[model samples]
Target chain A: MAEHPSSPIPGEKPRWLDQPRNVTKVVWALVAVCALLFLSDVLYEKHPTFAVEYLFGFYAIYGFIGSVGLVLAAKWMRTILMREEDYYDRDR
Target chain B: MTAIAELAMPISPGLIVILGGLLVPFLTAGIARVYVLLLSAATLVYVLGLPSGEHAAFTFMDLDLQLLRVDKLSTIFGTIFLIALFLGNLYAWHERDRMQRTAAQIYAGSAIAAAYVGDLVSLFVFWELTAIASVFLIWAAGTDRSFRAGMRYLIIQVGSGVILLAGVLFHVHETGSITFGHIGLGSIGGTLILLAFGIKCAFPLLHNWLQDSYPEATVTGTVILSAFTTKLAVYALARSYAGTEMLIWIGATMTAFPIFYAVIENDLRRVLAYSLNNQLGFMVVGVGIGTELALNGTAAHAFSHILYKALLFMSIGAVLFRTGTCKGSELGGLYKTMPWTTGFCIVGAASISAFPLFSGFISKSMILSAAGEEGHFITWAILLFASAGVFHHSGIKVPFFAFFAHDSGRRPKEAPWNMLLAMAVTAGLCIGIGIWPEPLYAMLPFPVDYVPYTAVHVITQLQLLLFAALAFTFLMRTGLYPPELRSTNLDIDWIYRRALPAIIRGLGSGIGVVWDSLIGGGRMLVSATIDGAARNFGPYGLIGRTVRVGNGVAWVATLLLVTLLIAYSAG
Candidate 1:
């Protein structure tokens, strides 16, 4: 949001979030969380209500794969669904 | 206190809002907020005082109508509706449009009426009223597109009401009862009623209306609209036709399909709209399960869903107001300027994605766990898959693209304090419910015995979310995520929006061509007939021959004489 007319903060103060380096920093933090969650999976008391719940890091793997699959599937769908923004009102 | 005690006895809580709404516009803007707040407060107080049984009934023609029902079920829904109305009105206090506030009141009133009704006729009446009143929200956008969307939204909403009315007629005729209660889809009437609820519940194919219309609404309008409509349908389904097994599949399908649509959708508001549908799927599954625990789960889920979804809509609405756009393609790195909005949005995102110590985790797990308990193994699996899918689009994609993605070079100002206050209140509820769900659990229609904070459950939930984040990171780093493009993605509304209109236009043109040829053909035929008549009877033709008058008279006389002569001879 660097270009809004309201946002030309005179002498724009530097913030931690604005630094591009923070992207890498956040990525590493996310990875560490994932790793810790994955490792801690074994120690948790297992209440496998469904057979699938018994699998190690099932939710983690499921989430990652499901998400990747969703994006890919949507990209494929865009071939059919994507149209000009004025698709419905082209005649207007 | 005595006056309120007397007032409570005379009417249903719903009418206070509907009637008060009529009087709201008379008040000056300065005290209008106080007036409206007190009105809602009175409604809540009245609802609290109403006995937990059918209270208000009257006869219309020969039909007995129960306008108010206050059981545990209605009580829970009523409480939430009042809560939502109060918060929604507070959020909209700064809005200048008098008509919109009036409409919002009517909308909330009708929803409360729908929740509290004890008979099919009353239900049907209030059902249509909600549809009619709430379309104003869509129209409040005051854009041509919103006008059209509001119109379509109204038609479908009314169609559901009509279907329900027809079903009620048949059901009453067959059973000799007008009570709104359990009936499976075993007869024509039952199936029709089921279809009605299905449409409103937005089961799969009938679901596109939610996505198409809600994003087109005015900012606060969308927040209010999000709370009542679908959740009302869920309540109706729970009231009348719980445990209908087909809802299992309908609910499952609802959960699964929207994530893909959400992924490619460019409007961040529309993405939340899809996310709303996905969350409804969870409630639908619970109603389908129909166990006491499941029904309680549905109620609790709806309660939290309303707050969090409204929170999401508020955050997005604030962005739209500040920057005049919510397109994913047009937004990024907003947190640099609008930090409060960004934080509240992430809270909303986290709640919807079922992060631990957030709202969705507590309510959604009950449904999933209940499905496993009931041996609906396959339904369980699909829902499990959909949970991850929900986290992907709603949790990661919404916040990531709007606040944290590559800078789109926009730095809009922070949302107004009122907007942030609204978001903060809702966000607080989301976390409060997550941290201590007992207050929410105690209010459920059925005793909610399920615990959401089991060690295994929290771990699994976190795993699901964090891994989804990893996948998002991977997609972003690899450039595999679909770039936000300014494009419209067609959905089922294409039937009415494009396909049918195109056909009508084709027919219109075809009819025009045929009409032109028919006019030409008729002219030729007319000319031919006129030419022949000219030769036979016109002044320029045989009649114009010399001595025509005398000769024609003589010819007629001779023919008459010949006929007489022949008759005499024959005799």
Candidate 2:
């Protein structure tokens, strides 16, 4: 609930969201998080009786594939299911 | 001390809320605000003071009905319901619509009553009351589409109530008891009850009403709606159907399907609606697991989910309030002006996504751990995937689109102070519960010793969430992430909304055409009858040609004499 610093330049269009340097910062931070998770595996207990989860980076891979699969599937679904917003109310 | 003890005697908070709601319309807006807050706070206090057993019992037609069933389960739910009511009232403080306020009180009151009632019959009464009361909030929006949507929501809700009533009647007939306790699907009545709860829980295909109706509600209306309805269903399920094996698969499906739908949803509020379903799946799985830990998980998850989901709804609702739209495609760069809202929205996102040190991390893990320990391999796998999917859409995509995406250049002001206050309190609780869950855990139906913040849990959850984030980054970089489109996705509701109606209408019109020709045939019959009568009565008839009375009389006598002779010969 901390108040975010107000943008310095008033009326200056979108903040530095798309700047290459900022994107890299986010990517690097993500990489750091992944690396920490990989490292934490050594200290963390392995409770998996399932074969798939015993593998290194199993959650990472599972999450990655699951997310990508969801997006792809949803996109494919949209092709079949998506229609104009008023599809329900259209007069035949 | 005796007066205090008397005051602590069991009272139905649900009844209080409803009765108090009746007073809302009469009070000035300011007084009404204080009235709602006081009513909710008092109810919470009274509910907390109740002993953990049935009180407030009475007889109905020689059958006993328990109006208040005070226990750990009801306590947790009632507490959260009251908290939601308080926050919801605060969020809705600026609302000028009197009906929304009144309906909120009744809806919340009924939901609280449903949670506390001790018998199936009493539960049914409050169950239907919830549906009947809540629909007014949707209709209070006063748009034609909202009115139509409200009707649909009402039909489904009250229809659930009807099913519940039938189930209860049959259950009492078979078992000769109306206790609202576990009756698994061994009998038809129990199954009917499960279906009734399922309809409210939004079990997969039965789920379309949630995504359909919640989004159509007014800004504050959606916030209030999200808190009570599905969670009430979850409470019902946990109450009666705990450890039912079927719930695991159903919950898994509930968890998985919505994330995909949420991914491509254009309306941000609707996306939250889907996430709400996904979160309920976790609770359902917990209920299905039926272990003490799992049940605790379900209760805790529900408590946290209500808070975070309402927070999410409130944020989007605030957006809808200010900008008049919550479409992902139409919103961006709101952080430039609405930074406080953006901040609170992120907290809600993080909590829902189950990041460590957030409310979700503590509660959602209980179900997953239960499934794994119980060796429901497939259920665990699906839940795990859904967990990551939750983070992908709700955690990242929601705030990303609404506040941080390529700026659509619309800068709306920050949410009103009351809304911010509500979000702030909810946000604090989200973090607070995540950090220290003992208070929440103590309220669970059973003792909870499971630790949520172990090295293994944190690492695994982080790994899953970060990788999902990585996947999002990769997809976006590759230009493969689906652009938010202003389109409606065909779902189960299509049957009732269009397909079924169209089929009935087509059949009706076909019958109508046949009916029109049948009427035409009747017309022809009437025309022939008219012509014959005219000919017989007019100049062309035999009687009409006879002008002289004597001649007619002589002919009639001759005909009568001839007929008489014929009759005598035949005899």
Candidate 3:
């Protein structure tokens, strides 16, 4: 497999996305949104069907933990499950 | 006059499409596409016009059969299926592959008909028809990989049909009623039927066929394939196995596990397949709850899920169509070239992520709420976790890796106009449903009681999804997120695909060895017996020697004397 190319597309002016700073800006914006959402927990009236909903930023913490755990678990799973690209094709 | 008038019968929309599809190959390429679209549109109108309750009822072998059952549940499934058919045909308008077109039409038709059939026997007929018809779409790619994947897919699909038939037989014998109604796992028939549905629903271990095959199908073929088989199973489960307690855990497992696989998956299409499995989980949970609200959630979710899932598949298929690669490792910076597709892909991503104003948010929340309402605390918690996991993998990873990751510098043309239109329409449905789920909800099997856009609901959902996004961003920034690699991951299908075949080969060789040893031993025994006989009976032996003339005479006299003596003694 070819390694991912980092160079800008030839003969074309660099788009806004081509700059690393723009990506960082997007990430920072995402962080800000996350913070605002976490803080906005107080503004909404709560409907506590389960006890967990009463926790401050419960959804946020659960979501963050779940995602990180999933990624890490998947990364570990790759060690056992992953194989050469042509694994199935080789026997054929 | 009476006999002549009695010969007329109303046709099911499925049969209409199937017959129309059969006529596709005779038409020229350009005309066939238009004809299929028109025929599908006409069928959709016909389906819309079909009245509620059974109409095309008949009796055979003293058992009643309803070829067309139009209830609220079936109608919604049928409507969405027809819509999918029309959109699929329109999207695939550019292709001249008549076989794929025909297969797709029949497949869609069978699924629609299967949804509406009110009897188990009729359902089985359409079920197998769907299985038989849809394999060609996979095979349409015309590659060795596609061919093999198609075969595996066919075997599993048809295997499901076989199990369903067996269940139907037992069920008919036990109850003496062929009505396809709520069949809990109380009897062998019901359990068998659930297994059959589970196989198609991709319930955990039975799931690998979808991941194995859909990515192998042709571009348009994948789009068509995505809409039917699993959703049909969801319909079947909703019809029969509703309220089966076991399905709660089954559904929760279904919802939770696939996100991991989707996370590391390289093939964008396969990632969507995993996401499809996860989405089916929500529907399964709805069915398991079996309350009015929960079933409505199932129906609503199925409807919206089909559209968004198709949109995602279409986007990836378009990428595959244009760039000749769907591997995330090979695709990036495509937005610079195919901005429309990038935008459409994000819509699909956001919808699947269940953002505030997307289809999934409206539908999936109802199921979660159902779980919470019923005090299914563990399942509710699992679903909540699954929702965030979904956003991480499908919502972020798919669009990020494909369109906005590190530049691969491979600029391809934008998707065809037809494809863009199809995506645009499906995306519209996704957003429309999210905004106004009332129309969709009114079509449900029960009165709509759940509201999706409450402030608490909206803010909490946003909190869940955004934090998940933040986690993804953190992982990416930290270099902890798994890099997209060109490799195959083993799943449950590896047992059948690799392990079973290897075991069979081993057994065959073992049997060969045993047979060879037996034959060798038998041959040795026969040769040894012949050698012993030859040594005794040949010229050098005692009896048939050449010099036996004189010796034989003397021996004969001696023997005669001894015989006489013995006779005398006896007397």
Best by TM-score: 3
- What lDDT does each candidate get? 0.86, 0.89, 0.90
- Compose the digit string of candidate 3's lDDT tens values, residues B331-390: 888888999999999999999889988999999998998999899999999999999998
Report the C-alpha lDDT of model 2 over A1-92, residue by residue, as the tens digit: 00121333456753565355676677778878777776667776687768887888898888899999988998899988998998877884
Descending-lDDT candidate ranking = 3, 2, 1
Once fitted onto the true fold, the runs of candidate 3 whose alpha carbons sit more than 4 angstroms away are A1-6, B1-10, B542-544, B548-571
TM-score of each model's chain B = 0.92, 0.91, 0.96
Residue-level lDDT of model 1, residues B408-472, one tens digit each, is 66788999887888888889999999899998899888876788887888888888878988988
- What does candidate 1's lDDT look like per residue over A1-92, in tens digits? 21112323557775666565666687789999999999898787787777777788888888889888888998999998888999898786
Q: Where does candidate 3 clash, by residue pair?
A: none
Off by over 4 Å in 1: A1-11, B1-10, B535-571
Clashing pairs for model 1 are A1-B410, A1-B411, A2-B409, A2-B410, A3-B409
Residue-wise C-alpha lDDT for candidate 2, range B1-571, written one tens digit per residue: 7654443346688988999999998998888988898989988888888778877787768878887888899999999999999999999988877788999999999999999988999899999999998998888888888888899999999999999989988899999999998888899899999999999999999999999999999999999999999999999999999999999989999999999999999999999999999999999999898999899999999999999999999998989999999999888778878999999999999999999999999999998989988999999999999999999899999998898766666768899999999999999999999999999998999998899988778888888999899888878877799988899998899999888998999999999999999999999999999888777776877555546889878999999999999999999
Winner of 1 and 2 under DockQ: 1
Residue-level error in angstroms, candidate 2, position B99: 1.8
